[model samples]
Target: MLTIDITGAEVLGQQGFHRDGLSLSGGLIMDAPVGRAVDLTGFRVLPGIVDVHGDGFERHLAPRRGAMKQMAEGLVAAEAELAANGITTGVLAQFVSWEGGLRGMDFADQVFGAIRDTAGGLVTDLRPQLRFETHLLDDYAGLPARIAEWGVSYVVFNDHLPHARLAEGRKPPRLVGQALKAQRNPEVHFQMLLDLHARRAEVPAALDSLCATLADMGVQMGSHDDHTAEARAAWRARGVKVSEFPETLEAAEAADAAGDVVILGAPNLVRGGSHKGNVSALDVVSMGMADAVASDYHYPSPRRAALMLARSGVLDFAAAWALVSAGPARALGLRDRGVLQAGKRADLVALDAADRVAMTVSGGRVSYLSGDIAARLVA
Candidate 1:
């Protein structure tokens, strides 16, 4: 691992920023100086981002039809994007949905396998999260075995079947587009969706069973797009403690009341509200109903969201940044990183005077470096 004594920068610690130098050696932060010293005078060093929920890697994993033949190389590229954005710990959310194409089981198999096999050669801690469609009752039986086989410990349940529209016997607005993406005939796809929707009554028991099985296997479980307190409670009863992007204040407050982790989308914060017309992340965070902010679908939103939150005076810099760092780390059950402390993994980002990501270091190894900071590290 690369070792260095970094001095003069505004290093963020448990309390706040300090001018005291930071040291790294053998993939761990050191209590004192080690190896060559580097003067990072005008920079601000912050803990590496730990994105607990993100599907942004989907683009890199399969940019277009037949675009990513070599999946491992694609993962490397994904890690590079993560490193560039100061994310050392990134959870690449893949779906086991009926949507097919990138979100289909076959593609998910390749993605989870590639992450398990390829991330060892990459710097970022690329973990896999399987987003399983809740209405897939038939697939629930073998879900645990498949999850273990894929080496995925984190699973989130999503129900995106357009239940209301289907129940009304209305053709979903995007039916044709969804069929094209899945490469199934439109009528066939509609029928398949209707079939899944018709079995909605059976989903609850199936999910309860699946979540119990996963919990026994020591897997982490979450629910996506929770819209009501009752829905949040239902998930909580299954030992699914993380609620990602609760679409209503009722759901978010329910999570808070139950001591469950509430994750809001960073993109929502960046956009000033939920683009989908749901509850605002800022509102939830302001009321202390949210615990973490995730990238959701955009890799850069977490960093921007934190900075914007700080500037808005909703929180101090440390607390706001923690939503992206320490907060997510806690949600992911990772204790070794997320903070700049001796004996912890040496994961940190150096921001220039302009707050640009000048460099990112993961496990004491330089993952991304650019601008004038590169010359200083080399000197």
Candidate 2:
């Protein structure tokens, strides 16, 4: 096993920063001497980020419509991006939804197969997370076995349908375009949507059953885009404890009060607010309601958001940084690799003066090394 000692950097300790730096050997932080020691002065060393939910890899996987040909290549590219962004453990949120195309069941199988095949070669710990659309009742029965086959331990429930308009008998905007993307006739797709909408009352019971089955399988589950406290409470009753990207403060407070983890998108923080005009992540963080932040659709946002939070003076570095590191790790039941302490996994990222990742080490193995940092290590 490779050993590396990173010195002359301000390492993040349990309370705050430590000026003495740290050492890594045999894939864990250690006090004993090891192999090479790289001088990383003028840098800040912290735990590698753990992204609990993110779909940014979709662009790399498909790039363009009807263009996906290789999953392994896409996964490799995604892993490189993750490592470059200081993410050691990334939960790739793959959709098993009604949107069809890349988000459909067939494509999800391909992604799962490719992920399993590429797992051994990946430097970052890439985990699969199923974003299941609640209205896909037919898919629910087979999900348990499918999840087990894919080695997926995390699942998030989503309902992206425009229920209000559909209930009013209004066709969804761009209905024809959506149907074409799903390879279905516009009329047929509209009927399908209407049929699902009519059966809305059945959804809760079905979701409860599905959640029960998933929980029995030892899968961690969360609900996405929670809009109300009542909706969040319903999901919570079914054992879906994580509230992902709640759109209202009441919803977020409900999750917090229930002791469920509240996850906001990192992009919301970096962009100053939600583009969809939902709740502000900054407000959630300030109120101490947000427990963690995911990269969501942007790979670079986690690091930038953490730093930005500190810059805004709303949170100290330790508290702000934990949203991307320790908080997310703990949310996903990963008790290791999110802290820069002895006896823990040696997964750390070093940021240069410009706040870019200068180096990233996952499991004491250098996953990303760039610019002057690479030269110093080589020398």
Candidate 3:
């Protein structure tokens, strides 16, 4: 364990700014000093961002098609980027879906195995969130065991099928491109889709059964792209308490009403709206429907989004920062990190006057240090 004392930097916690600064020792925050004090003037210290869900690392893992031969190297690069952005804990969303290649079950096995094997070497606390496609009915029976084998605690159900076209008994567009990407013949892929669609009526029962088993195993569950309040309610009944990126305001509101955490994309806020023309995260934040915001496809968006919210007067600094820190931490049931306080995990980030990440400390270890901050620490 490492001990560090950061002084002169304004410490921001859930309550507000602490002028007295703070200290870290043995991987936890300390009330009294246990290490040499370093003056971090002209900086602000806040809890390191807790990203509940993010798939941005996909590019690092598979930057180009057929370019990835190993995951360990990619994961290392991903952690560097995460620490540079002040993310202490990140949930890497890996897919186990009908779509083959990177999103396929075979690839998922490689990812999960790499993560488990590389856990000891990781500086940042990286966890896996299995994004299981709901239509893979055959996988339902074995998923619980596979999740345990992979040491994954979080699972999110997603249905990426073109529901309107499928419901109309029509083949979804882009079948050839999708098949080529999945390394399958277009005709075979089309047949697979049709076969899966025909069993849609049986999906609900299978999903319910799987959710119950996961609940028994104490795995946290969530649903993605919920489109309706009724759909949100149905998911809630199956013990899926997290609503990730609800496509409609009504769905988000319903999640809140049921006391479920509503997660929105931080990029949506940074860009002012959803790229897909869905409900705006800014609007959801304003309506008090968003419980947390994630990086989504961008590693730096969480920090940028939080600062933007504060600068725009949508929320005060403390409240806005919470959307990325405490809010996501709590949503993911991570009680140990996300807030700056005595006895908590010493996962802290130091930002310069311009709000750029100058130093990041994860578990009391300096994972990233830059500019004058790095020079000062070295000296």
Candidates in order, TM-scores: namely: 0.99, 0.97, 0.98
* Model 2 per-residue lDDT tens digits across residues 1-379: 3476777888888688887758888889997657578788889999999999999999888998868798899999999999999999999999987888888999999998898889778889899999999999887788889999999999999998889999998999999998998899999989999988888888888988989999998999999999899999999999999999999999999999999999999999999899999999999999999889999999999999999998989999998899999999999998876888788888889999899999888888889998898878777
TM-score of model number 3: 0.98
Q: Rank order by lDDT, top first?
A: 1, 3, 2
**TM-score of predicted structure 1:** 0.99
Q: List model 1 lDDT by residue over 1-379, tens digit each.
A: 7788998899998899999899999999999888688999999999999999998887887789778999998899889889999999999999999898888888988998899899888888889999999987888888899999989989999988888899998889989998999899999999999999988889888888889999999999999999999999999999999999999999999999999999999999999999889999999999987788999999989999999998899999999999999999999999999899999999999988878899999998899999999889887
What's the CA error at residue 146 for candidate 1, in Å?
0.9
Error of 2 at 292 (Å): 0.8
lDDT of 3 by residue, 8-119 (tens): 8899977789778688888999988876878888899999999999999998888988788888999999999999999999999999988988999988998888889985
**Residue 300 in model 2: shift from native, Å?**
0.4
Top lDDT prediction, candidate number: 1
lDDT of 1 at 218: 100
Name every residue pair that clashes in candidate 3.
Answer: none
**Deviating ranges (above 4 Å) for candidate 1:** none
TM-score preference between candidates 1 and 2, better one: 1
lDDT of each: 0.91, 0.90, 0.91
lDDT of 3 at 335: 90
